[model samples]
Each structure stands twice: as C-alpha cells, then as structure tokens.
Target: MRITWIALLCLSLVGCGSEGGKTGAAAEAQPEQTFSWKLVTTWPKNFPGLGLAPEHFAENVARMSNGRLKIKVFGAGQLVPAFEVFDAVSQGTAEMGHGAAYYWQGKIPASAFFTAVPFGLNAQEMNAWLHYGGGLELWRELYEPFNLVPYAGGNTGVQMAGWFNREINSMADIKGLKMRIPGLGGEVFTRAGGMSVQRSGGEIYTSMQTGEIDAAEWVGPYNDLAFGFHQIAKYYYYPGWQEPGPTLELIINKQALESLPDDLQAIVESAARAANQNMLDEYTARNNAALIELVETHGVQVKKLPDDVLAELQRISTMVVDEMAAENPLAKRITDSMRVFAKQSKAYHGISEEAYYKARGQE
Candidate 1:
C-alpha cells in the first residue's frame, strides 16, 4: 500500500509540472496581434515636408512592427480641418493627430512651448530640452487633462521669416499688412501692427496671388519653394524669429493609448521618437538642395530682414511672451523653463555655432 501511494504522488507532481510548462510555452507563442489605427495631420497629405513626414512615420511604424500595427494617414481637411485635429483626438474621433502644438494654445496655453517660442532654442537644443530637461514630463502632465498623450513628431529647423510683395525696411512696413501667419507668431504679429490671417497651405497661395495677403510665412526653403511663393512675392526673407524650432506633435488619445498592449504602446512611442529625429534630418538635407533650386533655377530673390526691424520685432516678442505667460500658470512654467534652457544653450552655442560662423567669415 505504501509503494502504491508513493507512485501516485510522484505522478501528480509530474502532471503539475507539465501543465506549468505548457502554460509558459503558450505565453511565448502568443501570436502577435494585428491592429489598425488612424492618423490625421494638419497639413494636406503628401504636402512637402510637413505633410510627407506623417506618411513616412506611418510607413516606418508598419514596417518595423512587421505589419502587426498599421496606421492610415489622412491629410488636413480629409478627416478633419487642420486646426481641429487636437479636439478630434481628445474626443476620440481619431486615434492620433500630427500638428504643431501652438495651434492648440486656445485650449492649453502651455502648448506653445512644445512647438516653439520667438527667439527660442533652435531644433537641436529644443530636442535636448524636451527629452533631457524634464520638459517632456511637464508636457505630458499638461496634456493629461485633455485625455491626450503628446509625442515629439517632427521639427522644421530654423525657418524663413517669409515672403513679401514689398520691402520691409522698418517696423512701419508691417503696419496694416495682412499676413498669413499662424500660432504664437500670429499673436505677436498682431501686437506688432500687422493683421495676421490664419490660413492653411491650400489657401496661402491663392491669398498671396490675389493680393489678399501682402506677406506670408510657411516652412523654410523646401516647402516655400513647393508652394511657389516666389512667383507671387518679390522678396523672400530669412530667420523665422517667430518659430525658431517648431516641433510637430503626435497627439494620441489617452484612453486609446491605454488600451494598447504593452508592446504596441512601446512601438507607437518608439516610432514617433524615430520620426522626430528623421524629420529634422530630412529638412536639413532637402532644404539645402531646395534653396539652391529656388535661387538658381526659379529666380527667387532672397533677402535678410533689416537689422532694425529684426531688433524691434525681438523686443516686442519679449513683451508678447511675457503677457501670455502672465495669463496662464502652465504657460508661465513652460516659458520660464524654455527661457532658462535657451539661455544655457545660447551660451554654449556662442562658443560653437556662433564661433564657427564668425571664424568662417574670416576665411
């Protein structure tokens, strides 16, 4: 009887072990599930750098995930209007949105810091602030209330001031000028004596061509050239002071994000991070070639804003930023942090980019 009992006990132990092994193996073999998501952007689909970046981001995500995760890309006005993307995502009408954060300032004043600040850090330094300077955490906290999870989607490096039909020799030139500008730049311009009209890419060309807008600023050379702003305007200006480093954002719904599996969630965040880097590189590479084409092949005339105008604008920009900060607590924190980061970056850059350029001039 004792020998029989021992045999039964051993058999039961083996059975338990086998069952546990099977459970482990099944977990390992869990077929990676497939999912489809929708991404909407502020720019028209495939519309140069701004629009094309989202398409590329989606392709990269799908390819990298081995088709386990798929995203359909929609351009501005296709799924929603350009400015409506934030609300669309927050309300769960769409899973994701791609656009500049400043466009959402009406909802969250701190949104401007995620995009850019007048006379602020350029692309490289701004990335450091967002990723390494505790800025991203603050950004997420601010977006949480809106049920949105924001990611750095892309950046247009230092941009051009824009194109003008007439010369802007002094601050007086901007007076009464109807300019197609967007975001915080528009607010600053309004305070500086210009009438700022917020228009989408499709509308800017016609507005300029028909003389409805005397001036307009888009992204730098690559996009400005594609829009054919040169044909309508005689002078193209440089140093987009308003948008030193405009970071495009990927606004994902918080609930939608939470529903994603751990792996899928990681894949989405990683894909956006990769896209942020890729976009800046794309703009840097393409802008060089596009600028050459604009000046040489297209007869586009490039001009630097007069020093007096730039200085005056910068002064007004300081006041505008301060006034906005005073109205919003979150905006105040972000603006203060941004200013600190910018000052540190400028100090370092003064010895590097600034020094290099100065030395190059001597050569």
Candidate 2:
C-alpha cells in the first residue's frame, strides 16, 4: 500500500507540473507589458488636416494594439516646439513625430525630395512612388543617419497657390513679393523674385495679419478656410505649383521602434499607413465643400494663377531641382528615381486621370 500511494503522489505531482508549464508558456505568448509613447507634431492640437492626422494615428494604434501600446500626442509647443519635432523624436524625447521632411532642410539639405518637389508628383503619384517606386527606401537611407525611421504619414493633394493680398497679374507681380512657402517650392519661389518665408502653421495667421508676409501658401481651401485666410487675404489662387503633393512624415525613433515586440511594431506600421491614406481621403472629401463656402459665403475671389507665372515658376523649379541634385550624389539618385517615375506616371495619367478629368469637366 505504501508503494502504491507513493507512485500515485509522484504521478499527481507530474500532472501539476505539466499544467504549470502550459500556463507559463501561455503567459509568455501574451504581451502584458504595456508601453506608453509620446508623439509630437508641428501642428496645433487637433487643427484640421495637418493636426488631425496624428490624432487619428494615435487612436488607430490604441484600437489595434488593444492597450498593449498607447501613444500620447502633443501638438506644437505642448511638449516641444513645432520645428523641434525632428530633434524630439531622434533623441527619444518623443517616440514619434509628424511633419514635412523639408522642415529639416537646414539640418538635411536633401530632405526636400521626401516632402515635395516643385511641380513634381501629385498626391496619387507621390503615394505610389513612396510605397512602390523605391522612394521609401531612399527616405529611410537619408534619415538613417539621424537615427530615425521615416513613414509617409500624410499627404495634402495639390494645394492652392496661396492667399495673396495683391493680385498676381503677371510675372512682374511675383517680383519682390514676400510669401510663406516651404520646401523646394520655397527655393523656387525665391529664385522667381519672391521672398520665400518660412513659418510654422500656427504662426501663419499672425505673420500674415501683421503684414510680416504679403502672401501665404498653405494647404487647400478646407484647411485654409479653417485658418480664416479669407479674412486676411482676398485673392485665393489655385494650382499649387509649389507643392503638387506634400507628403508629411511620421518619423519614429529607430531604437524605440525596434524595442517593441514584433506584433506591436507591425501595429505601428499598419496604423501609420492607414492614417496616411485617411488624411488624403478626408482632404479630398472636405476641400470641395470648404472651397464653395470660401467663394459663395465668404465672397473670396477665386483666381487662377496666370500661365506666364506658372511657366516661369516651372522653369525655375526645374533648374533648382537639377542644381540640388548636382550638389549631392544622394540627391541625384532620389531625383532620378522621382523623375523617371514621374515620366511614366505622367504618360499613363495623360490617358487616364488627366483625360478623364477633361472629359468630366466638359459635362
């Protein structure tokens, strides 16, 4: 009886050990350590398109991660200044950042290509190049030195030329004009006899109001209307030749991103992608209605930028882009990639998007 009782106890202990092993393994499989991250941006807290994109990204990540990861977002000056977003993310002061890459051109001379090239790719084409045409790889390579990982966070489709207090009748009007523009477009504007001024989104109103800038080229009518530019400037110009498609960046700290579990990392990537497209969708839907209000309700004069002015800007844009490419080898690679892709896109779009627009406009 003693021998039988001892064997049964051993078996009971073995069964308990097996159950315990299973429980431990299951626990290991589940990620229970939650991480809280801070995301900083070059936008006001929840201000329309530029600001709202980051907020939406945070929400998407929380919903997808199911609380495994949470990101707390800070608008410009809340955690860091708008222009400090790059430094904040790279130094791990913040885990993520949102803004255009060109904002960092003072630090990275070739940074403008990732954001927007003057009269280059439109929104759809820009998205394609980033995702498929090797644009993202170049962006990563360029940002790697900063210890950052770049994602195409958001895009403003073709933007308006800007709000001008003085009418642009010809190339002569562009001379000696001061305007708030960014990226390579700003450079082109400068070369075209206009003073290219740089100001963060929040400061645009005060600058324009105080006559610090004679004109400001912000985003589309939807975002521009929200800023009440109609009250500031009467001439709302179209055909944003400066930024055909400005792809805002979601820059993440390399170390912080790699520290996450595989699934959480994937969650972040997926969420960024979703937010990128979501901004475009929201802008596409909202810009039209806001423009109607700007014209009919606000009595804003909608004007087309004269062809001569566009032609001059285009000529200068090509020259500067070429000069920029010549200044650096990496710029050459990026410009070549974009130009080749742009050629293909333009050819196809001529038949598809451009043709369809023409056909639709006639109706």
Candidate 3:
C-alpha cells in the first residue's frame, strides 16, 4: 500500500509539471499585438520628396517593427483635405499626419517657428536647433494642447524665392504684386507692399494661370519642375529667404502614439528621422539636375533677387516677426529661442560653412 501511494504521488507531480510546461509553451507561442494606423498628408500622392517622405516613413515603420505596426499613407484629399491633416490627427480621425508646421499658424500663431521663420535657420542650423538646442521640447509643449505629437518629417532645404511672371528689379516692383505665400512670410510680404494670397500646392498653378496671382514660391527646382510652374512663369528667382529651411512635420495623435508598444514607438521615431534626412538628400541631388533642365530645356530664366528688394523684404520681415512675437507669449518664446540659436549658429557657420563654400566655389 505504501509503494502504490508513492507511485500515485509521483504521477500526480508529473501531470502538474506537464500542464505547467504546456501553459508556458502556449504563452510563448502567443502572437504579438499588431497595429494599423492611417497617415494623412498635405502633399499629392507620391509627389516627389514632400509626398514620398511619408510613404518612406510608413514603409520604414512597417519594416522596423517586423510587420507589427503598419501605417497607411493617404495623400492630400484622400481621407481628408490637405489643410485638415492637423485637425484629423488631433481629433483621432487619422492616427498620423504629415505637413509643414507653418500651415497651422492660424490655429497656433507660434507654430511657424517650428517649420521656418522668415530669415531664420537654414536646414543644418534648424536641424541642430531642433534636435539639440531645445527646439523640439518647445515644439512638443506647444502641441500638447492639441493632443498631437510633432516630429521633423522632412526639410526642403533652401527653397527658391518663387516663380515670377515679370522681373523684380527693385522694391517698387513688389508693390501690389499678388502672390501665393504662407506663414509669417506672407505677413512680411503684405507688409512689404505685396498681396499675399494663401493657396495650396495644387491650387497655385491654376491661380497663376488665371491671373489670380502674379508670383508664387513653391519649393525648389525639383518640385517646381514637377509642378510645371515653368510652363506658366517665365522667371525663376533664387534664395528663398522666406523659407530658409522649412521643416515639414509628422504629427501623431497623442492617444495613438501612447497606445503603441515601446519598441514600435521607437521605430516610428527612427523612421521619421530617416525620412527627414532622405528628403534633404533627395532635394539636393534632384534639384541640381532639375535646375539645369529648367534653365536649358524649359526656357526658365533663373534670376537672383536684386539686393535692394531682398533688403526691403528683410526689413519688413523683421517687423512682421516682431509683431507676431508681441501678439503671443508662446510666439515670443519660440521666436526668442530661435533668435538666440540662430545668432550662435550663424556666427559659427559664417566662418565654417560659409567660408568653406566660398573657397570651394573659388576652386
């Protein structure tokens, strides 16, 4: 009887161990949770660098997350209108969005500082300011009220001044010139005796063709060629002072981002960083080729803005930016931060980057 009882005990222990092992195995086999997010953007479907950045970001997120996270990208007017991307992401209509931060200036007067300010930081300086110079933290705090998180999605580098129907030889020529411009740049243009009309990328061509606008500044040569602005405008101007280095944004709904697993969140951020760098590289390579095409084949006359015109624009821009800073405390904080960073950065770059470029050109 004692032997039988001992055997029964041993069998019971074995059965319990087997069940526990099975449970552990089942837990290990459980699949990871997957997420599907929709991303909306202000650019048309696959429209070169601007539109392609989001698509590349989506693919990167998917690949980096090992298919656990998937983001579907919709171009302007697909899920929502181009201008509505911020609202869509904020209201949870879309999980994410891509666009320029300056587009939200009407909603948040200080938002323009994140994208580009007239006569502000260029791409390299802006990137440094954002990633290292406390710009990102300020940007987040500003967006917290809207329940959205912002990331640097891309930068267009220094954009072209714009396409013009006529030559701008002097400051007087800018008077009453109707143009499609946005952000604080638009305000500066208004202050400088020009009519600044707000229009989307899609609308600019028709507006220019129909005589609604006399001048327009889209992006640089790459996007300008794609939009075929050369077909309508005879002269292309240089040195986009209005947008030195406009940083496009990738905004995610706060709740949506919070729901992501930690690793997935990291993947999203990494993807955005990659996309941001990718755009600058793309614009650099393609803009050179496109500029040659525009000048040679397309008969687009490339002209530098007269020094007097640029000077007047700069003076008015300073006044407009100061006025904006006075209007809002947040704007003041952002602008102030940018001002300090720009001063320090320009001092260094003037000696390093500027001097290097000058030497290289001479060579």
Task: Show model 3 residue runs off by greater than 4 Å.
Answer: 1-23
lDDT of each: 0.87, 0.92, 0.91
Task: Tell me the lDDT of candidate 3.
Answer: 0.91
Clashing pairs in 3: none
> lDDT for model 1, on a 0 to 1 scale?
0.87
**lDDT tens digits, residues 1-363, model 1?**
366976787576745446554445666686877878889988988998789888988898898788988999999999999989999999999999999888887777768778988888889988999999878988998998999999999998999999998888888989999998877888888888999897877789999899899999989998988888878988889889988898999989998888878888898889899989999998999998999998998888889989988888888888888988898787788788888888898999999999999999998
Model 3 error, position 83 (Å): 0.6
| Models sorted by lDDT, best on top | 2, 3, 1
**In model 3, where is the ten-residue run with the lowest total lDDT?**
14-23
Among the numbered candidates, top TM-score falls to: 3
Identify the superior model by lDDT, candidate 1 or candidate 3: 3
lDDT score of residue 237 within candidate 2: 93
Candidate 3 C-alpha lDDT tens digits along 289-360: 999999999888999999888888898889888988899777788889999999999889899999999999
Which residue ranges in model 2 land beyond 4 Å of their true spot?
1-31
Identify the superior model by lDDT, candidate 1 or candidate 2. 2
Per-candidate Cα RMSD to the true structure, in Å, reads 2.5, 3.1, 3.1
lDDT of 2 by residue, 29-117 (tens): 76588899999999999999899899999998999989889999999999999999999999999999999999999899899998889
